[model samples]
Target chain A: MEPAGGSCLLGKWGHPVLQAANDTFRLNADFFDYTIIALYFAVVLGIGVLAKRQVSSSIDFFMSGRSLPAWVTGLAFISANLGAVEIMGMSANGAEFGVATFHYFWIGAVPAMLFLGIVMMPFYYGSGVRSVPEFMRRRFGTGAHLVNALSFSVAQLLIAGINLYLLATIVNRLLGWPLWVSLIVAAVVVLSYITLGGLSAAIYNEVLQFFVIVAALTPLTIVALHKVGGWEGIKDKVQPGPEQLSSWPGTDLTGISDPLWSTIGIVFGLGFVLSFGYWTTNFVEVQRAMASESLSSARRAPIIGAFPKMFIPFIVIIPGMAAAIIIPEITNLKSGEGDTGGATYNDAILLLMRDLLPNGMLGVAIAGLLASFMAGMAANISAFNTVFSYDLWQQYVKKDKPDAYYTFVGRIATVAATVIAIGTAWFASNYDNLMNYLQTLFGFFNAPLFATFILGMFWKRMTATAGWTGLVSGTAAAVAVAFLSEDAFGSASTGLIGLSGQGASFAAAGAAFVVDIAVSVVVTLFTRPRDEKDLKGLVYSLTPKESLVDPDAKALPWYQSPTTLAGIGLVIVIVLNLLFR
Target chain B: MSTDHDGTTDTTPKKRAGLFDIRFVIAGLIGVYGVILVLLGIFNASDEELARGDGLNINLWAGLGMLVGAAVFAVWARLRPVVVPVED
Candidate 1:
């Protein structure tokens, strides 16, 4: 028998059982696998080449000529948001935390996506704004626009680099490829497509990637479920603590490790604040919706995405939960141990693929992994270029540049963003729990954003000064809460200021959101409101009836209406929540 | 909004052929991968390989599914090629 705690020791590999497990878990791809992966790359590059012909102007480059249909944009909408973190980290969380991780999908993503489609898209699409920050410029004036644009651009660059870093690390671990090799390859591929076809290239690749990832993962999930004896078998073998199994997080808050897993935190912080902020304000995701052929198409994009978003948890979360039972040692896989021994929780999906999948299927799964990482990085790169060129360079640095000039600058921005992303990735290497840090960073950026957007869209009385002040103050509040909580509770505390990671982020965002609203309301009362005529189509109350209604929507069958589709989506979400609960 | 050098508005819609569309890329990938898997499933099976797949050639089935998906995208693209809209 192996040692009690350190069973993953080098000597343990010699043991018969350990040898079998380790052999299967190592990189086992053959010539066939490499051929499949090479074919995928060739196809991606060819697509990039073909897409370049469509790019004649800055608008086409940045917004896909705003001509995408509902199905295309809708699929791309969800795919753009499906980062390496969503596939790997969510699975890691599933293995570690169990059913509670589903909250990130259902409570955290679905409702917000629906809200974006049904409520917010009218203002965004009808106004003919090129980007999310442009919406800010029209609604609140230049100051708010600058703040949002700068923050988003910087964040996108950092995120793109992180995506590169993650892809490299996963490739290094899975294929035994060197880190530099994976990074350069990913950078080259992403830059090629993004710079060539622009947003259209990115969106098309994203839609393609969505199917590839699903096809890749579906087999693994099916095989793993069969290996583990099915759903009941997974539950029986997992032997999780009560909190791990319970979806109603409030009931077993004390038993759960993270304070953020608390029902209140999940609902308020992830569900409301972060979800709304991200789905509504983040242009990386919303850019897909905005690219639709019509206002109604834009409205239907996120609604369509919501249906698939509901089912994603099954593909992503189940593998992790199954791994928890089948390869329990994965959860204990720590950092710093050599490649073979220290397989961390993040290796949950990888471990399952290695153990369960045969040769040809394994190659496809790895390709899917590559596709997901590229899709995520491409999304951020495209968003970064758009925001930098239009919002920053055009607005501030070089006003009245020709359409071609802006398009040229956008391509140049893609290269610059990739460089900065690499730098951020190198800097991020110093952090231990990169995903946790990312979540906190997201909270800081997004929480205050939702507050600003909600008030700006709904309340015409809100002043431009208030808009800028609320955003700045809300971000500051979130940052202050994160730092102060760590200091007060001691760095080692799991729940700082009486909250878990998600909870802490929620608290910070919640505090920031409240502070932004309070400050905005107080300041708006004292300040002058924008002219009602000036607010036409920009504010909810001032938008015209024609702009508000989707002419095609009324003509469509009842099931095809955005409202009915959203209702169906909500029903699925509620059912999933109940089933898991 | 900018006038052309000849002083006329540029009204030509920017649209590409369905073959050059990005969906074609999806089709090409799915088709290529599907064909490869189907070939492998039929001819290249050792006893160990069969055991590894638990006697079920998942490659053949998945490959067929992927081929169908590719055909759907191809048809969709052929039916409605992307057309770059006139700027509002």
Candidate 2:
């Protein structure tokens, strides 16, 4: 039980988990491929050892001592998010929905990230809170802090489990290994690095993983696109409709049959509510930006991140779209021509990779997949440990402990959370499309938290009691919607209407957001407001003008300035939307 | 440690994260893999393998592309090694 899942972690894990087909479609990954993966693991562990030497305090452990530059944190910001969900789940969406899938990128992500950088980041960075929960604690008192900390911790563990299950499933199918062995091995690799160097190790490894992911996926996309004649070829091949090529009013992508309601859902439910809720308030990504050396760099982190983000769907989603055309199993499944060969949309990326890549490149792609899954889980685990140790443990159980004690507590929390994640992976195994499950989790956790946060940050009059009540009621509303809606919880749902897939998650999110705002407003009007004196840097209007932007920023050129760079990002994304629309 | 001529000892290096600058690690690893893939592409290509993605020697082309990526990252990291103090 204590050997940390055996000493031979990489030796067993080095086998590329590529095939989902029975025997007819094997990955054919040879010696060079395994060697590449093995070498990548060596560098990954080596990074842990290097980063460990930098950690001497709790701040250093959990926040990288807030010393990382903007570029590193910026790259880490996006990389930490380039987990199993982005690679596998988005690609799955692509295989199912085609070019309409780009909505998740251009509409669902970029604008919110730019907004986080330009508008909301000032309060977060200007206030000297260690974690998002700590910020909540200062603003709303213990009730809100406890609720935020507990829910955020639970969400991280569950999301980490999703990454764990998919990685293990891939290993199980490809190598016929037992699920426990694969799960343990995958868990141990992330566990080793995070426990050793903490967030510093996680951030550095994320930057590496980001590049490996780009390098690995670019080849696969080019090859897949070449195999099909191009986007024109894919459109012609997957005939019978032109709707797949358009990004707006995506009835199929949203899982809502009515084009009008689907556009409303995509815009209000997804583009505004869920995206802002996740991108702005979620601590997992926020932690990266928080680790930056300067407030301006912190502010610039997400804006810098948005540049690469604008183009990622071209590589991720397009390949999945190609798979639906190029691969026989998926083609049959999409066209209803024959049996699906037991392949789901989740296997779209792996199926395509198995069909196209050669041995050496195959190894690189496998390593890339492994990097992404680990990056996602590592982000979750690192965030979990920080909140557990600092916000939960130190605040409630062991107050006034030495900083070193908290650092030790953080390491222990990482180990414990990784083990718990192994158990939660079972829950994720029930879903065929992980995006639905992930979106449901976000709707439940992030939507309500975003409502509580956005209200408190802007309105200053919202009291402590309003904060926790709004959070609880908002979450309950989302869960209630999920339960009443058709196909959200499978058998648990009442099948109340035709709502299904991403549309159901969006409905749940929308319900949470509206209910949370309404409840918070009502609760605030009834309760005593916090003193305006206490709301100095925490609230928008209360905060001084000087606190928001760096004084040195005025001297810097337009490209380096946060708002200027963000404007550039906005224009490019708008053009991308225009071109794709 | 020797004191300065002004008799002031140096501040502890707690703030310096070293110019080991993580980009070198990113570049070096990607470059190594790129080189290996290029080697394999050159040595182990059959006509059947060449015909897989429009007869384009994918491993070789991908390897070259990665090497270019590695160079760009390494150059970016070197040209602007940002470790000095800035306004808080």
DockQ of each: 0.23, 0.32
Task: Mark the regions of model 2 whose C-alpha exceeds 4 Å error after superposition.
Answer: A1-25, A426-442, B1-19, B82-88
Candidate 1 local lDDT, residue A574: 95
**Residue A80 lDDT, candidate 1, scale 0-100:** 84
lDDT of 2 by residue, A296-316 (tens): 988999999999988889999
Alpha-carbon shift of residue A452 in model 1 (angstroms): 1.1
Each candidate's interface RMSD: 6.5, 6.4
* TM-scores of all predicted structures: 0.88, 0.92
* Best candidate (score: lDDT): 2
Q: Write the per-residue lDDT of candidate 2 for residues B1-88, one digit (tens) a residue.
A: 0100122245533222234568778889999988988987899876777777768788998999888888987887666543423223
